[model samples]
Target: MKDLPADARPREKLLARGAAALSDTELLALLLRTGTAGRGVLQMAHELLAAPVDGGFGGISGLLHAGAEDLKRIKGMGGSSKRAQLVAVMELARRAIGQQLKEREVFSSPGAVKQYLQLHLAAKPHEVFAVLFLDAQNRLIAMEELFRGTLTQTSVYPREVVQRALQREAASVVLAHNHPSGTVQPSRADEALTQTLKAALALVDVRVLDHVIVAQGNALSMAEKGLI
Candidate 1:
């Protein structure tokens, strides 16, 4: 990596042309900082992405779910500092997305809701069922991950979901969960759970707005598909 001209350096390119000018690998190389004795930082970054860390591919989504120990498994990422840096970068990204959601009118923008859910639930290594509680006007009341399960399935209790909605005094809700397998297609089980929760929440006068299935970087809205 050091063999590259100064103008071609990741940091220099970022400073000269800004972050938008860098590719995903270039941004990752900046985080890696240094490489192993036999590898350059840029090469190491590429290897990290190429290596199968999760779902048979070491993509950015896999990295987002990787802990420090998981990151250390990468060839040039054995150092604790490098592991921490990578973990910190992912945390910053998650929080930045959260901050953006808080600033926007969530219900008015379905795309924003999808973006927030994707950032929050997508890339998780296991199943997570979450709810976005909204006021009568559709403003966000709260967001909660209510149930967690194995990689393939989660047992969502409609009673618990309804209780939380009542507690929040939410007038509406958005249901969401992630398929770690990187497919946003709603399963039969997903549809069943949504219907169950919808009926349960309706008893308390809470409307079910949508059920979104989040995958890698994509999301599918049940409402849009006429499934909800």
Candidate 2:
């Protein structure tokens, strides 16, 4: 009916077409059904996605650094929408952090880390560098992101990771990153980076559990293959 809104309107079509009837924009529009006087929620989401950043949502760890006032600047995003997006971003970061800490013993399974990272980082258009700081028991003390950048230029410093480990008093750590390309294969740089960090942490007596590569539906681990 003409009176039915866009979101409700889409549901009927979805059920009729088995979800294949929707366009990417339509799917995104469904996520944000409401719009403002000048801009619709879908339009705002599109604009946000279009912004140039590493891994797009991949690099959105910076969203944690975004003040409430900053999010309100979007045309159709008021307090609620802004908060929703912010909450989603923050939770993604929190989960990534959690996966890292889980690496002590039970956390030794890279599959677990991959499962967590894939949910948040794989769909991104850029890259995310994340670290998990764990206590001796590997109970998940904290998970932190070390860098966010384009697919090519992320400034991941091993010293910073070492410093954070010392600060958290973590006995060990796990490092992970996402590949927006949907490939779980580790690049030479990825291998080199993990090796570099492993050696650096050795001096301070902290352990490098594993370096995980997360793709859309898959993951690769350095430790499982004896690369670490």
Candidate 3:
């Protein structure tokens, strides 16, 4: 990487033109910093993303789930220091998103919830059912992951969901889960689960505002589709 002209380097380009001007690979190169023998930092970054760690292109979502050991398996990332840096960077992003969600009020509109949850859940390698409990005025009370299951299915218990809502004294809630297959379309089971949770929460005088299915880069709201 050092052989390149100073203006062509990832760090230099970022400083001169801004981060928006860099590609995903370039951003990754910045994080990696250097490369192993015979490989440029940019080449190493490309390989890190291209490795089939999670069956698909190990994009940002794969990186989010990667551990220090997983990173060590990458050809140029054997060093503990680099692996720690990568893990710290991913954690910082998650916490920053969490802080942002905590500061905002959740509303009937699904935009904010989708944007916030997508950062944390969309990249997950397995099924996770979660809820954002809200106050009477629709402010966030808590966000909890209630269930986790295999790659294809998660068993969501409406009773457990209701108990958590009641425990938190929540007035309303937003339901969400991710499709690791990168599809935002809700399955029949998803609709059934939503109805079950809605009825359960309603029994305690709490409302289910929406059920969102998050995919790689998109989300679907059951309420918007009139399925809620």
Listed per model in order, the count of residue pairs whose N, CA or C atoms clash below 3 Å is 0, 8, 0
Record all residue pairs in model 2 with backbone atoms less than 3 Å apart, i.e. clashing: 54-126, 55-125, 55-126, 55-127, 56-126, 97-143, 102-107, 103-107
Q: Which window of 10 residues has the lowest lDDT sum in candidate 2?
A: 54-63
- Tens digit per residue, CA lDDT, model 2, 61-163: 3333344565565556656765586667557665665655454554655456666666556655578888877788866676677788753323788778889
Error of 2 at 20 (Å): 20
Per-residue CA lDDT of model 3 for 1-228, tens digit only, reads: 678898888899999999998888899899888888888888877877774753324677667767788787678777898889989998887776666555666664357678777766887778888998888778787889988874222467787888999999999999989998889998888888888888888999999998988876788888889999
Stronger candidate by TM-score (1 vs 2): 1
TM-scores for every predicted model: 0.86, 0.57, 0.87
- The C-alpha local distance difference test score for the whole of candidate 2 amounts to 0.68
Our tally of clashes for model 3 stands at: 0
lDDT of 2 at 173: 87
Which 10-residue span in candidate 3 carries the lowest summed lDDT?
50-59
> Candidate 3 — which residues are off by over 4 angstroms?
51-57, 108-112, 150-154
